[model samples]
Target: MDVSGTRATDENTRPPAVIKATARQLLVKVGAGGLSPEAVAGDSGLAVAEVEAVFPHRDDLLTALVIDAYNESAAAMERADEAARAAGASAGGRLLAVTRALRKWSFDNSGEFTLIYGSPVPGYHAPQETVPPASRTPAVLAGIVRSALENGELTPPRRAVPGPPLLRPEAVELFGGLPPAPFSDVIERGIVLWSSLIGLLVFQVFSRTHDSVRDESAYFDFAVAVAAEGIGLVVPLDDGAHTT
Candidate 1:
């Protein structure tokens, strides 16, 4: 889609697509603050006026990039989940699958990943419009939780943990309202699962664990399996043992 929210056809989308493609390249070299209509135009071989025609303001271009990154990352997870479902994998298996897919995407597209998940670009506040695409990845996680609950793959904690509701009204509504009883705690666990997934990816992507961790891929599976247990999922680790 173009900045105007209109779906872009082949001919029209080509320019914005080219512009965005070029902008992504620039994001690596110059960082977000360095992005501008003139920079994209120069790198893309288009006139500055043409770049401005699509993205008159720099933030418009940044928003488009942010939206694209979220969508592409979410698409990877969604694809992984679909494949796991087709293979009759359990929800725990699907959780591992999606996180693995996202991990691969983050490594493959570190620049884009960092663009969205890395440090905030100075002076840029994401508009409310970014919310939907931003929600897609976590929504995928929530779907896995819902399926697990329905299929009897996940059990809520037996005892009510003493605390207020983990999710606010809006977040609860967004996930199709709270599940009954302690089952709602499962949703909170799903949230932690999502956060830990991203946190692990960030640590790996930024090379924060390179010194201490050997065989990152194996380590990721182990970590995600551990996280799954927090939500009552029983994913198998690399050694073929389920997380306790």
Candidate 2:
């Protein structure tokens, strides 16, 4: 009846579930400073060989966890976006939605978020050698810029700056009334804005500052206002730019 073949097939199919559950357990232990494969295997009542059969290596587990966390966060962000849009939110409103969503994700999934965002996982380098565009904070700023461009918030196109060395046609179209500067300038500003948002979130999540002065929603509003100002969007008065 080829029972051996049937057993092998079943084991192969079941290993993935065992591996995922084992990884989840290990992630929980990671915060307690006990996140070794051996520890996880011992805790899960699985042999080291069985654990490795699923995860292959420690980094593989971490990478899988990171990817899983990212997918969860992204899903939450999409739902937040939908909710904001349904409530007739403007770009500023969407910015708040995404910011709050990210903050909540970090707070709720501290271990997973810390592993991915706070420190690099061993042996598992990002394959692209670049951050995911959607995950990049600059991409969020760029989104605001794009929205502003579409809404006719930026001044009309006219050559204002001094030099004209090289430029992308898309860049030219977006930075209205701005000179033919390098695209790097725009990219740099976006990166700066992105960094600001991330830095604020990290600070708030980690509780680096005193609780009396910490208001995540207010900080988020300020960040959005600053980003909007950088991209020439009409700054909303109620965005908490002047608040702490």
Candidate 3:
């Protein structure tokens, strides 16, 4: 099961226990500034040469960690969604629950969130082949939008109305009735919220601003509130009502 060895099984076929353990340990110690392969090898009790043999470079380890963090976030969101559904909440309620879960995840994993969103490491090209299917944040946000529309939470633009509203879609089910806005807009706004939250934490983390702000939990709560406000604007509560 140790992948950092010669003649190892295909990565896809390897058990995740070893990799996950190593990654978890590294992340706990090194908050997403990224870790060297040598560091990971020492922590994992594997030989430095063997770590290089498997990961080849620091980028591989970072890419793996990013993918892992995203998967964990998505799973958490899914659980929140399921809980909301069980409570007989509408799709809009479920979407908000998922969004809140994501915000909480970001705050909890600030290091991982910063690495994935704040900045990309130099010379670290993500291996397209190794990227997870559900790790794309934009696509996930788009799915939430579609769900809100279907749940009668958002309104499509009305054609018969004048100007911009007239040009918008009239209903959620009708593709043509959907707004002309691109998916990128939603993704960008989400990233902005995430980055803003991280920036606030980074300032506090590095002692760059507000020397008096010693309570990390208080700052995190403020950041979450800001992120929630951004989501409210991007998704808009009135869309569903407008459509109805």
Candidate 4:
């Protein structure tokens, strides 16, 4: 039946996946500088030639990892938003759900999170192909804003931020233009919100606020709620606690 040859073919097809998995492990242990075809081969029990055959170049492997991490993180947020919508949560609540999903993903895959969001990989300039996946996470935020505006759930902020079009032309085109008047600034605020969310996770994942923040989960909710206000979304703060 030539079972051994068939098995060999199957194994050959899986080297990229195996090599990437091994690379991620090494990434956590020794940082991006430690990544190389030989390192992945040694960890995956594959020949260096096999790893190189799959990745072709070190930058190729790094790009794949970046894209994978971005897509996975975006999927996590998308899933959370879908579930929140199914549950009839408010736009603001969905925002919270997605942000919380990101935090959860960052916690679960800290190494991958750092790979994408932490310091830039030394000398690795990700190609343009990385942009689409990189945009997915922020696109999730933009989608939420668009949905909210459509449903009349999004409010216009009282004060303008002094810039009529804070979103760049490319960003405007990418997001399909800003939400109409009064809400025109929502996307800009959303950009701020997105950056704030990432900054919050970065602080926690990198232990920047360990000494100061008493309760990270609670703090995140508070910070997100505050940020959401700038976007005209009203996220509920801790429901149980009464502040005097």
For all candidates, what are the clash counts?
0, 1, 7, 0
Model 2 regions lying over 4 Å from their true place = 1-34, 122-124, 129-141, 154-186, 211-216, 234-244
Could you give candidate 3's per-residue lDDT for residues 114-157 as a string of tens digits?
66655666777666643553344434444655565455554333
Ranking by lDDT: 1, 4, 2, 3
Give one digit per residue, the lDDT tens place, for model 2 in 1-244.
1001111233464655555555565665565244556876787677889877766666556555656666666667667777876887676666666666777787777776676666565445644423352354334445655565566555432333345425455444444433323322443454455667667767766777446566656755666667655544454546443322
RMSD score of candidate 1 (Å): 3.7
Residue 122's lDDT in candidate 2: 48
Candidate 4 lDDT (Cα, whole model)? 0.80
Q: Is candidate 1 or candidate 3 better by lDDT?
A: 1
Residue 42 CA displacement from its true place in model 2, Å: 2.6
lDDT of 1 by residue, 73-142 (tens): 9999999999999999888888888888899888888888998989999989998888999999989998
Clashing pairs in 3: 153-239, 153-240, 154-239, 154-240, 155-239, 155-243, 169-177
- RMSD in angstroms between candidate 4 and the native structure over all alpha carbons: 5.7
What lDDT score belongs to each candidate, Candidate 1 first?
0.83, 0.57, 0.53, 0.80
* Model 1 lDDT on a 0 to 1 scale: 0.83
Error of 3 at 158 (Å): 11
